[model samples]
Target: MHQFISVTFSLLVITGLRVSVQAGETRPERSISRHYISELTVTNGGRWGSWGHKEMCPTGTYAAGFSLKVDSAPYAQTNDITALNGIRLHCIDNYRRSLNQYHEYSTVRSEVGSWGRWTDIKWCPSGFLRGFALLVEKPQNTGDNKAANNIAFVCSGGAVLIGSGTNWGEYGAWSKTCEGKGICGIKTRIEEPQGSGDDTALNDVTMFCCS
Candidate 1:
């Protein structure tokens, strides 16, 4: 299940610039608000699972941060194939601000999996991390695996290095980022090993360079 929240704020400005009290008489400022939604799908057993649905920010808000959890490496000590466990998003509400993130996920589910906690927000120095598209794959049914293998974040420059997984699925082509003017940031979440015979997955992403 996904959860969302909306926040509203006001910024005082004059003549396309922020004015202090001494600059001039106080003028009424425009008020704006935005809603943020978090969406996810049930987990799968192996690498042949469906792609998780995508979660977009509200009409007036753009993606500012993102987070994902996966199953991989030592955590999957049984060497069972893994898939996406969780997904999250952070958005900023700016009527004229640019879009920051774009994403897609598998639509199939083979088995049920667990989800980890959300990660902290990440931001760029001068702009938001621009998102391009998503890549998804499902590996063959073998080695304790039969679900969506891995998903990749295709950025403005290139694909996000999310690490290894089953290598038998589909790849979503790249797309253009959203329209707007602002910097970008990267949000990531990883689930470590808890106890014996636990699975592990890395959910790290790269940031967009501010120019």
Candidate 2:
């Protein structure tokens, strides 16, 4: 059976702002300026790690592209593999520009594993990212385990963009499409380095959509 941890956070949304109110303090400690209307998730995520802080796109931008932090083949073959380490959301203010011409944009990511190089950004041809699917490896009893291996995104224009991640697992079902403009935020579940135990890096992920 797969083993993992679930993290809970107290979130307060008011007037298009997301505030985090931990268990103790009276006032909010941090606030995200952007507002998300819904969340996207998959069922085949590997079981491991704790959920990281949610990272959001800027107030007026949405995710139109993404990049992956991956441990390439040769490196993975020689070391304890952590195939997919991180996922980054590339955000832009304008969705009307041509796919090949994004002169200005911002990138955001949640907590990431420590053993990979970031791949080049992959853009959606026509519109913003609306949904996603993950390729995840099942738990290998006593064997080397690399939880998440690859990812794919569904654009609003019906085009799909796949990341250059390791080929170790099968792609799970696509997440439910966004209910608003597009995806605007991300939260990742990442496994920390295990001193001598089998290490599985990125385990699961969730996407946020905004209006």
Estimate the TM-score of every prediction.
0.39, 0.82
Taking all chains together, the TM-score of candidate 1 against the true structure is 0.39
Best by TM-score: 2
RMSD of 1: 15.5
Best by lDDT: 2
Residue pairs with backbone atoms closer than 3 Å in model 2 (clashes): none
User: What CA RMSD would you report for each candidate?
Assistant: 15.5, 11.9
lDDT of 1 by residue, 27-135 (tens): 2221222222222222322322232322234344343334444555445435444455544333444432233222221111112246333223332222333543233
lDDT of 2 at 39: 93
Worst 10 residues of 1 by lDDT: 1-10
lDDT, residue 72, model 2: 71
Stretches of candidate 2 off by over 4 Å are: 1-33, 77-79, 95-100
